[model samples]
Target: MIDAEEKIVQMADLEIDPAQIAAYIALLAEEIEASVDKEPGVLMLHAVSVKGSPAKIRILEVYAGRAAYEAHLKTPHFLKYKLATANMVKSLDLVALDPIAMCSK
Candidate 1:
């Protein structure tokens, strides 16, 4: 059965150089999407950028619960992405969110 309980999630806002935006987007579109789908308890994974500010990327990830979210950080793809983009990213802001309500019925 699907878990309907509230979940804690992490949102990451990343700012990159304009020149590297295209490459970052292409890399994520080709690799990250499929990789994240394989993770357990990952309810949703999304990546978006601000209009006209291609260098700004925001990722919203929701997990089944705290354990699931923690597990995701240990995944290979997450580590790889962190390493690969370390130099490309100019700034990163991460926030933890507490979900109060969710309607998926």
Candidate 2:
């Protein structure tokens, strides 16, 4: 078993169809809320759009570990978001991250 998932991070870059921005955002927010509320392993799912680029979106996701990440993929909310936004998404890119140190005041 792969333990220690609290350090897992993922960066997703998305390009959405301008015509579907509102609808896609609604679905994405709904799913994010559901995942964060219902899934214990989901640490965070933050979505943002580039300045002056409404069609460009980016998401920063943090999970407890590998297991948690995989579990997220199979969740109902994630599936719903995936299916609903398939046509709206023009491109998607996922990047994995390794944590070294974090400092906060």
Candidate 3:
């Protein structure tokens, strides 16, 4: 297990059409929740959207560290998600953050 002192944050901004954004988010969340347990060092996954921006999606993913985050990106589930959602996403912005604290012990 990773030390609680180490944490990582991943933020994603996705641009999608308003009509399909809700369905896309629901599907993505289900996929994330289903796949997270298999991902090593993943602490939690939180997905959100702006109140006024139905087309925008924001994700906050917490991992054990940089290595964990990298591994997560390479997972089959993530790859599948990327491929499946390619058409739904118009643009994406991903940011990696340094961790100050973690929920995992």
Best by lDDT: 2
Report the C-alpha lDDT of model 3 over 12-77, residue by residue, as the tens digit.
878886767767887787668766779767778878788888788888888888788788888887
The best-first sequence of candidates by TM-score reads 2, 1, 3
- List per-prediction Cα lDDT, in the order shown: 0.76, 0.88, 0.78
Q: What is the C-alpha RMSD of each candidate to the true structure, in Å?
A: 2.5, 2.8, 2.8
How accurate locally is residue 47 in candidate 3, as Cα lDDT from 0 to 100? Answer: 81
| Residue 9's lDDT in candidate 3 | 74
What lDDT tens digits, residue by residue, belong to model 1 across residues 1-105? 555565657788999978887777776675467556687678877789989888888988788887777787788877877777777899999998766675554
Worst 10 residues of 2 by lDDT: 1-10
What C-alpha lDDT does candidate 3 achieve relative to the native structure? 0.78
Arrange candidates by lDDT, descending: 2, 3, 1
Instruction: Report, for all candidates in order, the number of backbone clashes.
Output: 0, 3, 0
For 1-105, candidate 2 gives per-residue lDDT tens digits of 334335588889999999999999999999999999998888788899999998899998888887888999999889989999999999999998775653345
Candidate 3: lDDT of 8? 74
